[model samples]
Target chain A: MVRVTELTNLAVDLVDVHKTYRKTVQALRGVNVQVRRGEIFGLLGPNGAGKSTLVKIMMTVVRPDKLVGTILGRPLGNRKKLALIGYLPENHRFPPYLTGEELLDYYGALAKVPKAMRRRRAAELLEWVAMSKWAKTCVGEYSKGMMQRLGLVQALLNDPQLLVLDEPTDGLDPAGRRAVRELLLRLRSEGKTIFLNSHLLSELEMVCDRVSILVNGLVARQGTLRELTEHTVEYRITTTGDLAAVKEAVERCGARIDNTVIILNGHNVAKVNELIDLLRGKGVLIESVVPHRFSLEEVFMETLGTAR
Target chain B: MQFCALIVDSLRHALDRKLFWILVAITVLVTLMMLSIGFEGGKVSLFFGLVEAEVDSYDPLAASGKARLVGVVIYGLMDFFLGWVGITLVIIATAGLFPAMMESGVIDVVLSKPISRPVLFLYKYLASMVFVLIQAVLFVGFTFLVMGLRWGVWVPGYLLCIPLLVLLFSYVYCVSVLVAVLTRSTLAVILISLGAWVVFSGVRQAPAIFDTFPELQKHHVTHQVVRAVSWIPPKTADVTYLAAKWSNAGTSLDIIPASAMEDVSAAERGQLERSNQWEKEQLEISAFSSIGSSLLFEVFVVLLAMWKFTRMDF
Candidate 1:
């Protein structure tokens, strides 16, 4: 039994969603997720980990074996709810005969945008994606990266409250990747919820405020990066003095000295502070103290290994 | 709105496809060839001399069987080649319309919008029907035009055949769409459609196959069997039959009633009245079996396609 919530607060919520293709290949196994308003939520997973499958279930592109979900507080497959959401699939292909502008207009029209509004939005989206010059070019003539950008533009055409993207930046270059990141951030700033699935963990780390990682059709870990990685602590300490004294003080404070450096592991902030205080008392000048940010890749690998 | 958008997009895509143009060209060329063989001023003879002209077995009674010969030739050509072309062109064009779009991932983009599955299916089917109607009308109309030019007069009844042709061909297109949904491979769809076409058209011609089922051995049973196999092609045969009936009516032989043929130039008004009554009765019967079957088949196929399309995943 799923509880009904206020529409204005939650962008997307799925409880015990299950999807099996052809009565086999259980792509989603009781996956639960909730994306709050105005946050870029990343659905991170490897190939065949049900990333796209989950997105498809949410968008109603494919029916779920069992879907207990809601979008914007409305039940899934509700047309009124769908009008407020835009989706870009992993492999976004449009009718090759249609030009970029025409394709956008077609989707915009399908989304129930007025004719005048569709045309205006198509132009604005094309310009925003930096494909205004190629607006008239047929989609088949566009490169893979250009098609990806166009797909992103189409996804944004309706000014949807929630944007669902699967592998949105799969074929993008560095510059294109940066542009997409900025676009998502801007949308987030404008109070839009972005639900994204990507293989690029670094980009997810940069853009996503929260993320969920799935393994073998189940969510292995999910939370803000700060919450998930906070349990592991790493510190950088610089001090000028006799290295032997600093090392001795670090060892005395229950810290390990590695390569002439004092290292503190785990959530024992008291031990790190003790070492710092001892070094200061020894008249060893301290330069800087910084905590290393944990990369999502490392966290993901660790999570996957633990799940296995 | 979603349905309308889908229809517009489908129409645009269909118009832009190279296959559409190729089909149009082939239809025009075939119509021209049929026209050049001039429907009027053509002789229909049943016998040919084998070696030297040493008294061939042609009796004067069988010499001028022009109407039946023309009917057989026209129906045969329409059924075998032109009808096949129409069905094949439709299958090829619409075979990949939805299935290929799904396989190529384009359907995801479409479905991601606010469109409903049923609406998408309806609109695409409508678009395909419209295309079929346009192509079929053009083919039949231009053929009629060339026919009028060569024969020095246009047969008004030929225009009546347009709806029949459109209905039959649209049904085939609908079936192709359903087959496409069932198997999302264009090659497989073509093969299956062609096989179905062959089974419906050629299988009934074999006595053994018809004899296996006692129910199909009745008078109109073969028609029903053929209709069950592939409903559209036989409808084309029916349309051709109606057109032939109309063309035959314009001839002098058709003016004389079977009863009045013995007493030539006697009781002209009575013969004309009786002939008109008999023609009306024959027409009513033809319309029931031929035209009615075509209409029913089209409606059935359309509904079936819509149902399947709505239930399909993509």
Candidate 2:
């Protein structure tokens, strides 16, 4: 039997959560995920892969047909637990007639922040999002990137324990994306759990401590990047001497040498050491050795396959 | 606090709309026009010459009462027009209120907060009602001022009708909201609401038409028929012949004697018994039923809107 106590301390735990729209389109097909506290967990998927649907279900914007989940150690859609979660939807829009400050204040009030604190936090968030200069400007005139920044600011207004962001960086520039990345990292460091749905694999690789790859409305693979991508060890060796000898030495150590590259399949670090030792003993002067880490994108493609 | 935010936001939104300003301008212009027309008192002729026929159906006794009735009819027309305008505006305004927010993905941000759905819906409904009340008061108060200026009397009872007018407008507004929840397009909501307006307006007139039908259907022996043949269309000759027969007894075939007509003056004989009291009661009943039914309709519309909104996908 699964230990339920493990989820007692978890930020989010979903067991057999299913959401079917009109009982036809299965947006989420029995998705089960566990996010530990104080980690930036990325939920990566392609278009129509149910990324936004899952985020919406978690945020209670869309109710699931069957949800056996706990958010912030409480049942899903619990009001008290909802207060502990902040959500920024994809392509977030605010009332165009309201100024940036007014929009933030409005959402802050809805989040039940103290009246005194609302003003202070609104100002602070506007500054944090680099929108202090345009705080008085109506959102109707704001650019898409500015809206994204403001969206993030509003999501962080309640100082929530878990921040659920759906494609939060969709319209941001490189600099804006960087700011969001830094913000997420800072929040994680401060012991806040972040659930991010992003299409940018590079951003996810840099920020996410753990990730779940969703394909066809189900979890294809889920683990830390180290756990998922550490299966293969690839080393590029440049040697000055005859490369034929180096190739033979690597092959003898049960390593495959393909075009001056030595690849050790699986976690066989010993073979790498043996190849290195053999090259040295054989008087094969190696110029440099470089190790290539598998990117999250590569791992995602590998696990999900190139069917798309 | 959230409710307050919703109210403030809704007011700000309504204030910013260009349609709202247009409505204000129209109301002001209409009030001024009514004031001018009311001040320039003239005899109201119910029938105008058509097809080279001079038909004058003008009442001269206590012309002020007739003028006041004319003014009241004008006010009713204005109220009906305002209802139409208000319904259109509310439909267009609220059509985007929820669906647009959801389409733009802002609902996720708002709904994910700690606020409950019922609280949010309540605030929105309250905000809409407040908006309707403000517009109704502004329009009706201005019209009252104009009427009081010309008539030299301000009826407080008319002011009491403001709530009824607001309730009527709310019925349309809430029904528009329900359409908004059921449809995805603003144009669809507006079209549906306009269709509803036509139906309700026609329904409200049904009782009056039915009440007058039998009396209007009464046959009469006209003087032309008495001179030539004895047949006249019952629909066309009833009210006129009845009034004439009641005025002069010798004009009919079954005339009592010329001496009977000589006893009473034409004006004295033309007046009907307790006509004013009966007319007042009819007006009161019609007004009461219209206001009560409209208020109940608004409540039902609001409940339906809430149910649909709660179950909607976005």
TM-scores, in order shown?
0.81, 0.81
The window of 10 residues in a row where model 1 chain A has the poorest summed lDDT is: A1-10
Q: Chain A of candidate 2 scores what in TM-score?
A: 0.90
Native-to-model Cα distance after best TM-score fit, residue B191 in candidate 2, in Å: 0.6
lDDT of 1 by residue, A1-308 (tens): 32446445778889898887788788999999989999999998877888888888888777888877678888887787788888888877778888988888788888888889888888888888889999999998999999999988888888899999988888999999999999999999999999999899999999999999998789999999888788765777766545675676577666775554666766667777887788778887777777775689988988888878
Give lDDT: candidate 2, residue A70.
Answer: 81
On DockQ, the candidate that comes out on top is 2
What is candidate 1's CAPRI-style docking category based on DockQ? medium
DockQ of every candidate:
0.62, 0.66
| lDDT, candidate 2, at A175 | 89
- Model 1 TM-score relative to the real fold: 0.81
lDDT of 2: 0.69
What lDDT does candidate 2 reach at residue B155? 48
